[model samples]
Target: MARPTVFLIQIFAIFGFLHLGFGAPISLENPLLRQELDKVGELPGQNFVVNFTHYSGYVTVNEDSGRALFYWFFEAVEDSSDKPLVLWLNGGPGCSSIAFGEAIEIGPLLINADGKSLRWNPYSWNEVANVLFLDSPVGVGFSYSNTSSDLMNNGDKRTAEDSLVFLLKWLERFPQFKGRDFYITGESYGGHYIPQLSQAIVRNNLLSKEKSINLKGYMVGNALFDDHYDHVGVFEFLWSTGLISDQTFKQLNQVCANQSFVHPSESCDEVLEMVDKEIGNIDPYSIFTPPCSDLSSNRLRSRMHRIGRVGERYDPCTEKHAVAYFNLPEVQQALHVDPKYAPSKWDTCSDFVNLNWKDSAGSVLDIYRELIQAGLRIWVFSGDTDSILPITSTRYSIDALNLPVIGHWRAWYDNDQVGGWIQEYEGLNLVSVRGAGHEVPLHKPKQALQLIKAFLAGNALPALQLHSDT
Candidate 1:
């Protein structure tokens, strides 16, 4: 059993910005801060030694609604200032980027299997760039709203608007990053979040050149590109992969063909029930991997299973650990989380936020088209094992874009092994992480790092072997 680390640290004025002993200079003059800033002195069950700095705090996005979005910042392991800043968001329309993106996936630390301690991850993206993980929209993770109504009225428009506000105010707190090269990345529904947020950033930069975010481009993985094609691709993947029966696939195509995957009709639901039977006990997130022990209940037999479970190498159970550690009073106190604002318990994804999510758009394809036209680096990646949002789904949407293939498809390598496959379109890139699941980083960290490195550098994925130098 792992125990929380107990330590004494300097406390700045309550909720006012407090430096976490990072050598970074602070002006403290930024009026955007209302309460004292919160800093994580140490996390509970973190026994591994680390040299990089981490901070946890809230930025008030809506003062009247008391809506504050929580964020955790990790400076790069090397010369921190020179590195580009990357903002990561996890999609649920309501998931905690901190809990999923940071703690369990590509962040510097990994929660131990005991669900009580921490370990360092060699593949943390922060090794190459400064990373910020945010739990956005009110009522998700440590992010909260004083007004109850705020929780029930969330959609892509509001989320994008509030997130843009959070970014502006956050920059005010850490002014050093004001003109730094900035990039946004996310996964799953993040396919929706990243584009919408990027659109806002682009518009803001155009409106006022003086106070513009140095927006570069964005990448989304295992994302929901378009509802119609996602529906089409999922059924195609299921049938083609032999995960579903011929009859079941045919019926699903006919019954649920023209419905929203997020909220399908009764007929669609029934067809999906047949899909459930065909999928049987397989993990929907990573069809070939064994699901965590907690997922074997008969109650989940025929329901849509979210892509969250532990693998043999990476503990899918890390979510449970994060909830326990973050909810600890001592840990919360050290992070400057005011008890009143914190949830009764932290969750990886919020049902309240998802339930109230008002999806107004049918497809973000138009947004992709706009961003591609804006000359921003756009990359879309998919984990081959994700059944819910399979690679086939991604291909369908990409094909719809009708972009000419600039770089023909080729297998990319990592550590002299086939990492995945990649193909560059005229303005975009589509990648598939071979043998990886819905959460690519969680299952294949090294390859995920390779993918990001290539994306950030605007270079093609490394070829397996350069042809003979004749």
Candidate 2:
């Protein structure tokens, strides 16, 4: 199963990544806006220079529930009007896409350590197409609900329904994007979100001929496939990678077998604790990279960094920087966040939403099958190093679908060097970012950009480009 690349995957994910710092937000003198621009504006301390424009605010998904979902939109670097629209959701079932997607992962800028500045991310997805980062499910990030019960009641089914409604209502605000080619992308738990929302869009498109979203396809990375496979892959990866002892791995499998991974039993938790201890003080998200060693600076805001590595060059301190930047009063006001929710600090992941998530479909394989049959451009990519939902686990789950190989497995390249590996199946495509963690784009921006661009263009990963050195 292994294919040799010119360079090791771990080195690319670590020393090869880029690291940037924050600058003050430049106030837009005459910020351009579409006719429906409500909270159209620039960040107060966003000092990075850019040609494209961005808009942010809320869309009420449910009036009776009084729940509003917040969103931040960035136009493409150039010719944004003609570019396709991509919706990005970060999975926590409760994490803020704004906190993760926008601030740290694929968004336009990475927050500075000062917590009051912004820096340009050269590989931001907005470079290719219009990108929308949504803080979904009422209580995540800047989104909230007046009806307290709505916060307590979020699940896969509800999130899918609300997201569909959010998309429809959001279109009303920017009707120009209504008929545009649209795609949804997310990670981790978003595996659930992408499929369910894509399925909803398909049903909606069939229902209404006049007002429908022109959804093209979707991509999910390092996603939760299903409980059994996810757990199996998690343990297997640890054992295979030599992170855990053979005894610990065997005990975990035996005791945790047929048990809930989400809410594991006492014995299972104990076994996991042993597994965690065996793995030791390394970042499980990206095992080879150095874990964030600084915690005292901003404990509350740093939680997001706990699960994964930070931006280019793998700045171990990005979590603290993001926490500081997002918590600034000026930044909050600039984003048009309601003051009522200010007392509660911004979080990368939501404890309430994660704990209260009401539903989890056993496996999205069925949904994948249905969507592939529907002829949607389905793509699944994985960060080869993610232990939580390892590439091995994802491979097992996708293999269950038995998709016929359209293109044989081969190494794909970027900048004329091997970036990762790709295998195209009849209805879907699977690509692996050699050294990335749970957040593929954060660690391997160049490769991730290439992956998304090919997916959006409905083409295969670019063939190896010849060079003088070669």
Candidate 3:
């Protein structure tokens, strides 16, 4: 299935819910959402349902076609006195925020190993600021659209626009949040997601005062910011780590430095070819490699079976147990998804193919440049172990930006132990989490949280300085 088609399926599902009052009251009782929240334990001094009641659902973005568009999920705790509103999106160009919400970071709950129960994350982001996790672009998670055509081609532009609409309406729904400090945050492709959406918010704010949205800053973890540098860095990392032989490394370096490096398509081809030739000889667990054709097929089948088995009970984008637990009939009825599709799987990263997107605007670098020029704060972070988009690539990509350095490179320490390295350039902050792979939060939660907290506070995290070893 094409990217657009996959998106359409999500839109159709969302619209079906909208027809049912956008699953409003029922969503409060949604089995999946409620179960996850319940497991996390109730707020410090408040009833569980009372805290959940702060969340409201309605069509945030309405197309000219009159189809009601809705985004569902919980709201961040706010004093209604003073606090910043932070909007969060998870990548996949198709993943839902709920994955990040319930499992990692901060929501009200955490899914257990069994995937059926939840527990509260005492250190959830809400402890500091109000956070909003959104299922976006119509077909992701609980957010949906009535018209298939309304589904974006899954490009950066459309995703940004749709998110903007959701943000505007979300603000309207909670008028108390207006004039409050606001920010955008996400992971993975969200590196691109948050910036694009922030730029759009800035543009709309500049055009009409009444329609303006206040966007403070943005943050991304293990983000895919620049394709050119990111790709080259991946190979360089492989070479440095001895994943590729001296001969293969030399060949790759020559072509990358001279030819393919400047061209994304050529570079991608070269990298894939090199990976194909050497992957079998290398340790799969040690270095991150793209999905080989054979492995890709197996992974695809597994994903499909997982998705098919879950049906509509829950999203099947994450892992298997996650699907079963979140899809229980009790969970579905509470989440407000049709009970018929109840007990279905929930995919945080499903391989729904019908909706592959092909019309994304230029490379991520192009979008990053646009956002920076538009005066939005951009942050790109990486987990060093991630072979898919390793720290080496992220470093190389940022180096190519040629932006003025606001802060020199420094080591990030944890409990007095060296944790990672970070640098600040103009309005953009770049950092690498030591000992972490693709998922920074999952692998290094404390470090990840500390870095984020400092970023949000608009202060520099402690810099790593060279240590003298005698």
How does each model score on lDDT?
A: 0.80, 0.77, 0.57
Pitting candidate 1 against candidate 2, the one with the higher lDDT is 1
Q: Where is the poorest 10-residue window by lDDT in model 3?
A: 304-313
Per-residue CA lDDT of model 1 for 1-470, tens digit only, reads 33112221123333334343555533345432221344455577777667877777888999998999988889899999999999998887678898889888899987776666778899999988999999978888899999999998888899999999999988877878889989999898888889999999998988886644898899999888787898799889889889999999889889876776556788888778778777777667777877666645532222232323333334545667777777778877767687889888777778777767776456899999999998899999998988878899899999999999999899888857888999999999999999998889998998999888988888888786555657
lDDT of 3 by residue, 1-470 (tens): 22223234335445442122233523323333322232222322222343533342335476664333333344555563465777777766566666654455556565655667666666566655776677765556555555556554455667787778777765655666777778777776676677778778877887876534677778877666565565567668777876678777666655553332212345535545665566453222123423222223333112211211111112222334455555565655445454332213556553441145434433466666777877776677777766555677677767777889977788878767877888889868888888765656655667867776787788777654456779
What TM-score, computed on C-alpha atoms, does each candidate reach?
0.90, 0.88, 0.73
lDDT of 2 by residue, 9-80 (tens): 223334433112244322211121222234445575666578887777778888887888989989899998
Q: Using TM-score as the measure, what is the rank order of every candidate, best first?
A: 1, 2, 3
lDDT of 3: 0.57
Name the best candidate (by TM-score): 1
- Best-to-worst ranking by lDDT: 1, 2, 3
Q: How many residue pairs clash in each candidate?
A: 9, 13, 46
Query: Which stretches of candidate 3 lie above 4 Å from their native place?
Result: 1-60, 63-81, 149-152, 210-212, 246-277, 280-318, 338-345, 353-355, 463-470
On the 0 to 100 scale, the lDDT of residue 20 in model 3 is 28
TM-score of 3: 0.73
